[model samples]
Target: IAVMTVLLIVVGLTACGKSTAQDLQSNKWYPNQKGQSYKTQFNKKTMIIESPLMNVNANYSVSNTSGKEYLKVNTDDEKNQKLELTQISDGYKAKAINKPAKADDGLGSFE
Candidate 1:
């Protein structure tokens, strides 16, 4: 019984440890802020920002620093732009970090 219990616990923890990359690839993400008309689709290492005007491509990565997770989006004009997310009922509320200000900080919701 002891061995079985330990095995179950290990399995449960492993299942809950889903990588952010896997979550990003699951669905297209929408913005939760105002005046932003773009959605994002994620590949293995890239994010496609789809807008009415044009589609922009960028690289992205997920990292954990000091027990907090951050999503880093890199574009032509920006590099290693970090966003901290708080999980809500339906999605994540993103806040821009390591910046003075941001207009793109919003919720990352999937449909």
Candidate 2:
């Protein structure tokens, strides 16, 4: 019974898709800063980021640790832009995950 239940749960989760992806995809992520004109779209294995600072197609992966979601982005110009993002009342709170750089600067609860 326990094994069946676990299998069912796993199957359901897989069929529904990863919650992190769904949550990330539901909203059009953008920088909170005004006048910057930034828009980001998250897909299964990639994302499109458009802003004055950078405009490029990037590959990304979502992972959860300690109940926190971290997004890793890799662009042609940059690699492994990791960010620990938490959903806030207004937007999202984000910070550098590992080695900080310009790529991780684009995330936060600014708007």
> Residue-wise lDDT of candidate 1 within 85-109, one digit each (tens)?
6666765666776552243432232
Counting clashing residue pairs in each candidate, in order, gives 0, 1
> Candidate 1 versus the native: TM-score?
0.74
Badly placed stretches (over 4 Å) of model 1 are 1-4, 7-12, 35-37, 100-111
Alpha-carbon shift of residue 28 in model 2 (angstroms): 1.8
RMSD list, candidates in order: 4.0, 4.6
Candidate 2: residue 59 Cα off by (Å): 0.7
For model 1, what is the alpha-carbon lDDT of residue 30?
78
Computed on alpha carbons, the lDDT of every model, listed in order, comes to 0.70, 0.70
Error of 1 at 51 (Å): 0.6
Regions more than 4 Å wrong, model 2: 1-18, 33-35, 52-54, 100-111
* C-alpha TM-score for every candidate: 0.74, 0.64
